[model samples]
Each structure stands twice: as structure tokens, then as C-alpha cells.
Target: MLPPVKKDRVITQLPQCFSPNAALHTKDGFHPQVKAMCQFQRTATVSFNIAKVIVVGDVAVGKTCLISRFCRGAFDKNYKATIGVDFEMEHFEVLGVPFSLQLWDTAGQERFKCIASTYYRGAQAIIVVFDLSSVNSLAHARQWLEDAMKENDPSSVLLFLVGTKKDLSSPDQLSQIEQEAIRLSEEIKAEYWAVSAKSGDGVREFFFRVASLTFEANVLSELERSGSRHVGDIIRITDNTDGHRRRKRTPQCC
Candidate 1:
């Protein structure tokens, strides 16, 4: 049976981060500008509320298990390898605005690499998952991210590095791998998280973070294009993605 959407996926307030070191937003809540816009501005008719998120990693690294744990709230013990690609649409309401994330679960097998790579285009965010107990999977995270970035502009996408099967790693071993993982995360500029799908720890928070961040980015981009509202001097919404407008010169403050 499918789980109730509101109980599991609805996000009324801004989701908090698990750690400061690996968090995208170090503060407690959404960006001040985003909050103000949502509070004051009338909701625009958004043609694009759905963000595409692609999940990639080596085989048996718990990518499928990690997603199922959040979307369905149950881990499948009888594991079947993902084929070319599988998808799920998760809905959320961030600060009274409706949002959705299109999760693309790509196969980690070598044979399916070509098929999966084809679907990597137009991704708003990339999640590179690895096993907490496997050091080699951690090493391959960079290559996976490189491959995914080829199809989309790097400046437009968000990156997340996730380590699964946290329960399987011992305290000592986890500490060591996490150090390396953190270093790698820093190098790649991806938010890092450790989760245990079987035990249902950190899975929900991780997805919530992803949804919240993507929603914020999309809204900010919309504001930048709309040009009808003003958040601050740092941001100017002049033209939409398809439209072009000349910026009016203003006197510089001395």
C-alpha cells in the first residue's frame, strides 16, 4: 500500500539540516529573501514547479533502497537490480507553494551506463550515492558526478553526495570513511549525508533537504526572470529565460 502523501512528504516549514559542515544552508531556515517573497508576493502561475533529480552510483550501493525508504517508507529485502531507469514523482508544499521533485533512479551496472547517461540531461540536481562500508564506491563518486554534469550546465545544478548503509558501518570504520567522504564532498562542492535505509534513519531528512533547496532555487530563478518583484539590490529580476530586456542604468551609491 502507498503511504499517505501529507504525513510523509508535506513540508510546511523550511527543513533543517543534519550537519553544519555538509549543509547547503548553514542557518536554521529558508533564505530571508525567499521567505519574504512567499509572505508578501502573490503566487505566480508557475509553469515549472517540477525539478529533475538524478541518482547515480555503483551497483548494489543502496540507491534503490535509499529512494524506496523515503517514497514508500519500506525497504525491500528481496533486492532486484534497477534496469535502465526508474522514476518517481514526490510532491511537497514548501511555504504554502506546491512543489514536486522528479527522481530519476538510474541503473548502476556497466551495461546500462549508456542508457542511463542519455537521461542525465536537464537535471536540476545530481545525487551521487555510495555505500558507507565500501571505500571503492566512495572513490567512484567523482566519476559519476562528472558524467552527470556533462549533460547540464554546472552553474544551474545542485550536487549532493550521500553515503548509504550507515547502520552496517562500525563506529571506527564509519569515522574513517566519513573523513574521506567529507574531503571528497568538499572537493566536489556537494552536500554530504549518511543514511541507513533499512533502519529508516536520515532518509527522510535528506530528501526533505533536497526538496527544500531545489524549491528555493527554482523560485529564486523565477523571481530573477519575472522582474516584477524586488528582493534586494543584489538580485534583479529583469527578463524571463526566453525573453530579453535591457537593464536601466542607475546612479551608483558612493
Candidate 2:
């Protein structure tokens, strides 16, 4: 059975680092031009209620541990690398509506790259995890993101740069690594988060933020696809006295 949805969850807005206009071109690919438009009004009913979230990064970066911590509330001390790809379904209640998120964990080894990359398509959110104590892991984030973005529509996918094993890094070391992580996050336009799976620090917050932001984005995209049609635009009424007249007009927004 899946975990129950938390009703007290409150996600007011997207983080400051999130930008809907961020450049989403993959490496060695043509950058598509996109035009910005004013925010359209959303209907009461959401067209999409499911979101797919993919986690990608280098080996031994704790991608599995992070997901386990969020989903099962437990972490494994044994280090077993992911083989190809694994997934888990998480339920959420966003803005008083029930929603579902599919979390995909891809293998970070080169041997499984081909198999894992095949599952990257149609992802609603991509999380790139790195080891805070390993600088090399941080450097490879760009390549991982490129591989995943190549199979997805970059404009529609939300990106996040996560640093795992926060408990292993010293305060001084963490500060230095954070600077570099911030620079890379800005370059890729992905949100930055630091968490310790073993200690369970910042794990819940990170997942909640991801779920909320993706939910909001999904709602907005559905509204745009619906072409400005508001909910309850059509209505019917009858007059008993006249019995032959009909009237209709677009409902006014209050």
C-alpha cells in the first residue's frame, strides 16, 4: 500500500530560484525559441493529476537512499548501486485536491546508461543528485542533466540540483561546496537543495517542494492548453411565464 496523503501540507508558491522562462536546451542540440505570455486564468477542474519525477546523478550519490527516506521513512546503510531503473508511486494532496507522483530512480553507472536513459522521456520533474563530499560527483551533474533532457521536453520539465550526504561534510567543507553548487545550479537553472538521508534532514521539505511546484506547473500548462475556456462557461435557465425565450452569455469573472 502507498503512503497516505498529508492534508496539512501547504505549498504557498514556487521558490525564488524557480523561473518558468529558464533556458532548457540540451547539450549539442538546437535551442528552441519560446515566446512568453501572460498568465491565463485556470479552471476549477485540473486536466492532469499525475506527474512523473526522475532522479539522475553519478553512482554512490544516495539517489536511492533519498527516495527511500522520503517514501519509506528509512535509510539503508549498505551501499548497493541501482541496476537499471526503479520506480515508486507517491500520493499527495495539493491545494485540497488529490494528486499522484511517480518517482523514477535511474542507475548512475555507465554500464546502465543506455538502459536508464531510455526511461527519461516524458518526465515532469528531474532531480540531479550529487555527493557533497565528492567534488567529482558535482562536476558530472551537467552531463547527467544533458542525457535526461535529451529525451524530454526541456521547457516543460522542472529541474533540481540536490547534494546528498550532508552529514558527512564538515561545516567548512559544506560552505565551500555550496558556493560551487550554487554556481552550477544557476548555470543550469535548477533549484538547489542539500539533504542528509541518514539523518533525515531536509528530506521531507525537498519532496514537498517538488510535489507542489510540479502540481502548480501542471495546472498552468493545462489552463493554457484549454485555450482560455473558463469553468462553467455554459449554463441553462428556463422561464415559466414566457416559456419560449432563451438567453446565454459568457460568465463574468468576479
Clashes per model (N, Cα, C within 3 A): 1, 0
Task: Return the top candidate by lDDT.
Answer: 1
Residues 103-126, model 2: lDDT tens digits: 888888898887788789999999
lDDT of each residue in 187-217, candidate 1, tens digit only = 8889899999999999999999999999888
The whole-model C-alpha lDDT of candidate 1 against the native structure comes to 0.80
Once model 2 is optimally superposed onto the true structure by TM-score, how far is the C-alpha of residue 220 displaced, in angstroms? 0.1
RMSD of each: 11.2, 14.3
Deviation in Å, model 2, residue 153 alpha carbon:
1.5
Where in model 2 is the C-alpha error above 4 Å? 1-48, 229-254
Indicate the worst ten consecutive residues by lDDT in candidate 2: 30-39
